[model samples]
Target: MATATYQNGSLSAASLQGFVLVGFGGGAQAQALLFAVFLAMYVVSVLGNLTMIVLITRDARLHSPMYFFLKNLSFVDLCYSSVIAPNALANFLSSSKVISFEACATQFFFFSLLGTTEGFLLAVMAYDRFMAICSPLRYPVTMCPMVCAQLALGTYCGGCLNSIVQTSLTFQLPFCSSNRIDHFYCDVLPLLRLACSDTTLNELVMFGICGLIIVSTTLVVLISYGYIIVTILRMRSRSGRHKLFSTCGSHMTAVSLFYGTVFVMYAQPGAVASMEQGKVVSVFYTLVIPMLNPLIYSLRNKDVKDALKRLGQRHSLVRDGSQ
Candidate 1:
């Protein structure tokens, strides 16, 4: 157990004081409201992503490369939302918002892992679209079942490796400083700020790993889409261009929201916790993005709408027959 005590301008590492997690300094009313809001978000995220997964899995008509990647994306979104939302909701409801040191580290590890995996997944999806549009003749061969599976595996593995390195380095330094985390979750910067020991190594590692992943993934997605745009422009039929753009609209929106929020959060210099502002930004990526995923994809997708209609008609017919 790490004992926490304040000594002058710095924290004393000689005594190990256990840490507690205090989320958003607010009273009972605020906590209750916050809890309700997070609970609603968690429910929506779970239901939305799960519905997509089930629909994609059960619908034989959706047995294609596109839907397969969508199914994978939904699964990733569900897990990603679950990793942070429930714990956040718990902290919001409780007056004593304390998380064990081990648990906090675990949360960060899994969150980083899933986040990196999602980045890779999005990049891969962009390449899929590129092949489909830019080289239609090679699309089927390029995105074969085996190739898709390998890409998915690589994304997961890359995410896991990145998380391992980041989490290990972040926690290696002694957190002899005050255990008061300014944010809702155990993000790298917040946790790093509490170190009783030096964190130059941690910061470098954090910036390096995060930057490399974001830059590499963004570059790949951009290059793939660059070719895709050229190919779309070459098509003489306006309807064909529109159809192609529409198919990619949902993915593009999701990728923009995700990468945009992440970039704002982690990319800038001198970007520390700004109390209320930080929480709001965190909400965009952690809460709002997860909730919006299904809505963004399904609302714009004709197949999803058709499937829902079919499901509703079947239910209606079943009710009439039962009556």
Candidate 2:
């Protein structure tokens, strides 16, 4: 049984200590509005990602390295949004934003894992594009089936390993005082702030590992794009250049949106955690990006558009033949 102590008419305890007074820093109306917005995003995100998965699986033409990575990206977006959107919606509806300690830890764990995986996977995709465009002759052998599989597996493993370090460090803190988390979800920064124990070690580990991963991946992506631009610039024929540009434009836009939001939200630690700004930034990266990824990729890709049209046409032709 959990013990409750009364302090100034507020019930508190060390056991369910973190589940005390809901969110200490937000209004009910605001929470409800935010919830509604995210609910729509969650719906779209799920449907869009599912559609991509179905399209890719059914379309034999999309069995190449590029589409394989895209399928994985869609799957990741589904899981990434699912981790937070449901709990966020629940928090908005319920009077208590109280999540159990174990639940909070689990949420943080998976969120960290998925987020890291996405960062690395995007970089891997950039490298794959680099190889395809900058070295078209070697694209086949360079990005072979086995190599693609290994890259995807490595991305997942890297994310999981980083998350294990972060989650373990986060939970190791001793909570002797206030337990109210300022944010809707159990984010590392906010959760660390609530710890009565010294968080220097945790912060160090968090910063060191996450910083290395983000910085290294960003650098690699930049260099890869640099080579790609040079290659594009070297093409003699205007039509050829235009064709290459069109092929890569959709992917470039996706990368820009994904990396831009993440870099803006997490690349720095300014007045965000203390003020309302962090929440807004978090919304972009956590909620909005996932929702937009599928739309951006599918709507922009020629292959996907063609596949959809073909699927519809094939269905219609079959029906007519049957008639």
Candidate 3:
């Protein structure tokens, strides 16, 4: 809502109509190269997530609670990649690299929404694994269709609330100092750095909310896995142990990637780093992780691979028949 004002070659708060995203610094060729790289990543990530969603939905074999959550996670990754990747790619090729106030706010909202939703969804998936491994007899009753739907709905609602609070608080601050966002996107920390007013309260609230979400969800996952580990140790069958580990391994890999980058970004708020360093780390979570998720799941899980193979065969048969 900040309007741009210019006076005698000077930019003022009134003149702040939009923000300049200082994405990356390089010559024309370098930027073009970066553009190509990011575009390829974006394409791959979108296609991979979409494929996962379609496979999960179409395959009746994947109708369980685990795949139900996996499908939702893939959808979140699809949207999450979109919230930042396309804009960043365009900025890589654009001269001005300017984003309107509305666009910035919108991007921040959906980015936070999907990120928060994914966090909670991961924790829920962890619980699902724990139930299956530890309480296999009661798993069906515990994680019924209604329960799974409710859990998914809860994550979406939680994400919306978190996004509303964070986005509203962030944009409420008076950004009189400058409109240059050092990082690639309109993230909390980068935007906070641009505010002229005292941001101690904002910082505290942001930290508290983010900490609560991350710490609480992480604790749930850890506790779930702890019980799972115990159960695995007690199991008599070696094949059973291997199967459970394989199923859990993919989820653990995703959790590690997501939580590792998030903790680095938010845990040490006092640790100062270069904008370029922040950008690199952000790229890992925002872009790289999403793209890696489907690969991790499919390559590790035989069920998904089998599903893909079946789908491929069906498509080939249909094509041959049509010809």
Among the numbered candidates, top lDDT falls to: 3
* lDDT (Cα, tens digit) per residue for candidate 1, span 1-323: 44456666565433434456667777788888888888888899999999999888877787778888888888888998888888888777666668776788888999999888888998998988888888889989989999999999999999999999988887666665567777888888777778867787777777777788889899988898889888888899998888788878888899999998877777664564575676788888887888898899899888887887877887899999999
Model 1 CA lDDT for position 279? 74
Residue 37's lDDT within candidate 3 is: 84
lDDT of 3 by residue, 1-323 (tens): 35566554444433568899998888999999989888888898999999999999999999999999999999999999999998998898888899988899999999999999999999999999999988999999999999999999999999999999999988877775468899888899988877777889888887788888889999999999999999998999998889789989999999999988887777567643777888888888898999999999999999999999999999999999999
Instruction: Estimate TM-scores for all models.
Output: 0.92, 0.89, 0.95
Q: Please list the C-alpha lDDT of all candidates, in the order they appear.
A: 0.82, 0.79, 0.90
Pairs of residues at least 3 apart in sequence or in different chains that clash in candidate 2: none
Query: Per-residue lDDT tens digits of candidate 2, residues 180-221?
Result: 776767788777766666788887787677678879998888
Off by over 4 Å in 1: 1-18, 317-323
